[model samples]
Target chain A: MTNNILYSIKDLSKSFSQSNKKVTALRNVTLDINRGDFISIQGPTGGGKSTLLQMLGGLEKPTSGMISLDQDDLEKLGEAKLTNVRAKKVGFIFQNYNLIPTLTALENVQIALVPLGIKKLESERRALAALESVALSDRANHFPSELSGGQQQRVAIARALVKNPEVILADEPTGNLDEETRDQIIDLLVNLNKESGITIMLVTHDSNVAKRANKNLHISNGVVTTRS
Target chain B: MFFTYLRREISKRKRQTLLVSVALGTSIGLIIVVNAASAGIGDAQKTVLSGLYGIGTDISVTKSIQPTQGGRGFNFGPENADSSGASTLNQTRLTVPIFSGTFDGQTLKQIKSTKGVSRIAATLKLNQIIFKGSIAGTASNPTTPQDPNARPRGFGGGNFNIDMTSIEGVDTSLTNVGPLSGVNIDKGRIFQASDANSQNVLADSTYALAQKIDVGSTVSVGSGTFTVVGIVSSASSSPETSANLYIPLAQAQTLSSNPDLVTNIYVAADSSSNTDSVQKAIEALLPDSTVSSQADLAKNLSGSLSSASSLVNALSKWLSIFVLLVAFLIAILFTSSGVTRRIREFGTLKAIGWKTNRIVRQIMGESLVTSFFGAIIGLAIGVVGIFVVNTIAPTLSASVVSPGRFGGAAPGGPGGPGVPGFQPPAGGFTGRGTGFGRAAENATTLKLHIGMNVSTLILGVLIAILGGLIAGAYGSWKASRLSPAVALRSVA
Candidate 1:
């Protein structure tokens, strides 16, 4: 682990019980993610790409070995501390644009700041700024149902970037969009990464998305391999 | 932000919100209506009792007349023949009520000394009978020798008329606790201290109106002509007063030939709670007499009022409770289901770093807002129910068997005039048949008026909140159990 490394992973493994059988999603995986790294993971469905991204986001716990973010062991932290790590250090974007249906696009973005204990007015201001960065400020008050797929995905990206987390974990962020909308979303995410220096770990099945990342990794049957 | 989110969420799911609110609201409304009806029945009971025992009377003591006690006797004789040889007779007798037996004034003293007795008044309840007719000249022939075994020819020959009036001997000095306390003077004045031993009389409004009697008119009773000094009516809604005529106790005792004796003793306790003890004490002193507290007297109340009281106390109360419990269960189930449906939403929030407590808070906030709206709807429904009850104004009739009147022995023998040749005068007395000593049992009718009080309204609100809390708690518990990984997996 170097001084520039934001995440240090060592021989981590994760398994799930499926119909009383142990199915491993990640096995003896070793990885290092440095600050400002744009890492893309590519694999088939159920091949541990989303599992690895969830682990890096602190949304899942590894069954063995150790993983750390900024010197704090993810496996050793209590529930409250783990939640705090997730709240202020990591953000997530789902493939389906998981914005709350009841709230406007701006409020969906502001929700990320809720767990950080920010005041409502300050949260709204920062949310607006995040939406502007994503070029979705014009649709800030539009509900998720009222927005196009690209616009909704942009709102989801704004929500992830609003907290200024050190890393954003996006699982197939453009998986559900058409080519034009997918290109627009990918451009927005790339711009956020280039300007803000935010680390991004994206899991995608599309080789085009993987080619844009600074580092590309492939996994199959719970095994990881870096692409040249 | 919290409130805005809550509002949006509630508005988005209108059907679910309405379901919970209407269930809870109907339950709360039923509770309010039932409680109000119970209060109204209580007031009606007070009115009925006031008609029977007067306003402040808490305990009443009386003795039932025995079969061997006595019977009414009338005597008519001829000093000679009036011109055509017919005997003219006119007689009026004031006697104690067939159901009541007199006790000396010493009993009143004993009751006054009883523990918790605050005020005591004694009264003599009497019945005045008037007979007016003349025997035929041929019916009572003095010169003719009558065979001892011969059947009389004039057995159905008399042209006599009879009338009976209910009267009360009131202790004017203690009107605060007796039957007189329940009357209002319609004309003239009530008795004064100086009128205690005087020959003044008060006529009940109904009786006076029927007889065309007014203030300063004269009415005959017990061989004496009394000037009607006042016209009085019952203070309650009952059409009939406690008695047809009110007379001074001294004059009643002298005229009825039962000196220093009273048939009924009315006692007012120091407080309502002490009435039982006072009744017990009086019962101990007068073991053979009937001593009744207000509650015991209420048992004697029959008719629509009593039925309403029973329905309000038993049926309505239980129904309200049953409906409230069902409402709470429905609310809890609905809220839990709503949370279950939003599992993916909650999982996403948890992944975004929202604490379990915050998610729980949001669920509870939604449930509570629904319940608050439910409370408002319930209040409106309850007010409407109360208004309907008042507008209907159902008249409930209540009859209390005057003490010693029920299941008692007949006072007199077979009905017949004292004269030899006067049969039962066509059809006994004018007003009533002399059947088995049945005393006049009067009924009081009152209009029921439901009322709303502050405490009941507060209770309705509190009940709605409680229902909300219970449902919210269950929903929150379910939401808290959803681990983000598992919740998201289920939705995925």
Candidate 2:
């Protein structure tokens, strides 16, 4: 049962110092994620949903708590080791579709493997296959600016997938898209999690998108409440 | 992957990179050219001085003529003097023959025995008047007459109107050595040691033309008519590049009615580097004599040329450091601005697990590439600038000219026995001194040699690379410090 748990979080807390004032974003949150679990975290604005995703990605340190991802405690790992974990064990998708504008879609995806030091030919092959999984192979050569919002987010998803990580941390990944494009992105992510058995954790403001996940965690005013 | 990414990034920001590189190149180019010219002038200065002072001769020792008790007032030139010579026009107006200082055979022997003294030659210079053939209508040479005739109100003896000429008696054996080594025979041969006792003469081309005298023609000199054997052009000619007549040392002494005395002695050292020490030693040896060295000649140079050389040397010394500093700062500022604009990009790279040191290296590579291009451009500009400068500037440049203590003279003139012209022919006109015998004056103009040498070229490259690194260090630091979290943060 312990080996099956992908993430085990206990008494997690986070705060920010803004203009000489401390504002708590997360308070005393305890959660557990099993392998192959597709979890969506929803909350009102400034309620630590995105902050929790950031922690899962090893992008930020928690003020206090224990976050164990696949038996490795993120808090205990040094920056270099944490980066290694991020690079090899987890991937990220962002609300703004953070694709390097200077690179084509294929290159944007290929960059995810840069730290792995793959040869260019092998990296491009993996990038193309990842883009194909997102149904974006036809748009592989297009830059982010040349792509529509939905297509850009799909490219970002491809970038996250190309690393073949065990889990994906997405923060409002479809928030910037139109209604139709948003639903299409949801179906694509659901298909990825169901078919690949990769654990997916996302922060979304939309309840409809939350309902599609296997598990949902709701937070309000820095405190968490569970929903099945 | 970094290089691929970097190349695209550079292309994207081509305008900014080009602007920075061009600015750096211009500064580097200036430093290169100015330093090269400075070094060139230094070399040219030495070459010019050696040519003027006498190549192979380390130290010059000349006796200064002083007035005696009995010898008196102005009996400037002979009543029947050579009216053909015009050299006196550019010389000190007081052209009267007087009692001159002399260094004897014993002194010459003593000097030759002195340690560190290599080879020695003696010369005697005299002022004489020729009363015969007038060298009136000759084609004028294209050299300038620097000194103008500003005849004094009451100068020279009354009722005497004869042409005054300058005559030099040289050790014909050593004419091909020292400064005389540069004297070329435009038409005929120069005098040789074997001709010392012969009545042969080498006439200055300009003087020969002025007097309508040709080589191998009989010409009246002093009290003798010697056969003309050679025609030569010399730097020591009276007005400047013109040739003065030359006769064998023995013949000159016999004609002047003087013997056994030479007014100046030139000593050659083993090498030019030893000139300063040899000069000091000679100064100590001939305390009453005037000792001139190549360094002395350089210091006495005057005019715009002196200022130009001094200004170039100063500029080369300090301007490079200042300009290169400014260039370094500009590169830093430019790179820093690029870093500011790419904060998100840097953040994203770090977020993707790219290490801080890797980012730093990427930035450094960009700077090194740009700096390499800048150095090449700078070298091109410098080479072109050197050619341009060399093309416009005149050849033979000298800044400080001390006509009083340092001037040109023939390698040989006999200071032997005295036969005063016409004696004043009073008291048999016991020839006394007028303090004008050996004028403390010389003229040397050097042609400018301007180009880049290996040292200056190496210096330019070093500055370019160092400037790039200095600027890159800051950009890399800023890049390395960018937190990966910035990419995840809200745009707000």
Candidate 3:
């Protein structure tokens, strides 16, 4: 039923002008994502996989189309409302980990709770819990530069999951890691989706990472196709 | 969270923080120093004006007159000759200076009642000339021509010498409002109320020193001897006084044969704000008299002190503004560049659901913290600068010319005199004019002492805060306009 659908897309399209030429990144794509679904979008470089992931996170707007997360329409909402949706309902992870170099691991996790206006002690307690979930509790006081790539990614994951959002969108979350570290990060995300019933949409080039998700979509040159 | 973030961010970039604070601190310090120096220069100018105008006397009124023809003369007759056909004549004449005109005593009463006049004092300025010499007895010399201009046959064989002294008659009861107000008693005592009608005088220290006179000594004026009650020095440390000798107003009027009249009136206004109005009122009251206020008097000043005043007012003022502008510009540029270097960081913040306003606030907080440190450094620098200025105490010299036209006097001598029983000397002699037509010049030297006030400190802090706000606004605007999507895409 429609009540179980977490995201509904209709005729979504995006384009950008590069060197005075319009290049289509996403075009007339329609899809539905049910609650608690783990979906992976695999595509080559310059494809629409990351664009779709960003749209789902409300980080980018569609040139023409309508997309809704629950009852709120991402296209119709103002910038402030979109920001609020991102704060309350969505979390994002980048390929570079993107942890603030000036802040420690615990502070990076606590930063997510800042927009929620939680009390300082409670934010700290919850941030420590999130670090424990990622097995990064011992490194809470370590800065990003002091942490290994896999450890920093885990801290990034702790930051994303600390807010208890409805969904997490990751753009190449494990692209910078080696074979063993990439598997660890992917296994952590899988456990978060399975144990917490939180929906996830990830864009990756690794077929193995895509194979772990329950649903997989492939795209190239702005067109999407289902992979059974 | 904001404070923690700001603290970490500033601590991380210690070099940039120090650079901005030092630049702004230099500007604010310069502003304080310039302002204090200007105050010092203003006091110096007031000192020069007060040399003649006197302190606490806000307005002055005077009138100028041409000297009388054939300037006052001294002659001898048969009665002035001795039995040896030799005569010694010694006489002292007290008269108003050739350039001053006296106003009626009734005008003083009217000025005292003027709307803004808080106090009034009148002075009669006079010049005393002493003529002491011998004249050949001409009673038996009938061969001498009766024509006063005729050249005689034989010389009189006598020498004459003349001396001039400036004298002022002041109201002993109200010496606090006129020229006497600017004098400090160096010896003896000031005039008491009982000395108002007596033949007592206050001699200038410089004049008394040069004349080898002291307190309790008697000085002759108009053939009358007056005891010197006190010896006074110029309050501004000037070389001369407004007058050499100060006597009671009554005695001066009587001696000068100008009874119940005053040549100059010194006025005190109720307040400094009322000075212009009082001057206008007095000007209207006596249309023919010249009324001058302190502001008007400052413009009439010249010499090195005036140049210093101009340098402080024009050059230092502009220099302060220019340095402040440059400092502010440097702050803005540094803030903008710091923000530019952190574009990806801000984009990551926004992507993590940090609102635009929150990020803007973080940037602004960092700038304000830096600016606070700048204000502290500026205050320290300003205090040091003021201390140095006061310690050095540079001296400046100022000169002001009298505000009236000089009157010329005609030369008088025995050559043109035809007194009975007096014969013209051979190779007739002539008395030269006193050459008093030149404008009166007053010069004073004073050491400058720069002082700091509470308001100047407040201004320095306010300036630092303003610079922070300006720089923060520009930086925050740049931070706020960042599109998170585009920013992340470029970095990726």
Q: Note the clash tally of each candidate.
A: 0, 35, 0
Instruction: Give the TM-score of each candidate.
Output: 0.83, 0.72, 0.87
Chain A TM-scores of all predicted models: 0.98, 0.97, 0.98
Model 3, span B355-420: residue lDDT tens: 999999998899988888889889999999999988988888887776752322322223213233
Best by TM-score: 3
Who is ahead in lDDT, 1 or 2?
A: 1
DockQ, each predicted model:
0.60, 0.49, 0.73
Q: What is the interface RMSD of each candidate, in Å?
A: 1.1, 1.5, 0.8
- For candidate 2, write residues B109-220 as lDDT tens digits: 9878777777987766666543332112112321122223422222122232345545667788886444355455766677777988887877756566777778779966
Using lDDT as the measure, the top candidate is 3
Candidate 2 wrong stretches, greater than 4 Å: A219-225, B33-51, B54-178, B181-299, B310-326, B383-399, B403-462, B490-492
In candidate 3, which residue pairs clash?
none
Fnat, 2 decimals, each candidate:
0.70, 0.55, 0.72
Model 2 agreement with the true structure over A125-218: per-residue lDDT tens digits: 9999999999999999888889999999999899889888889888899889989999999999999999998899999989889999989999
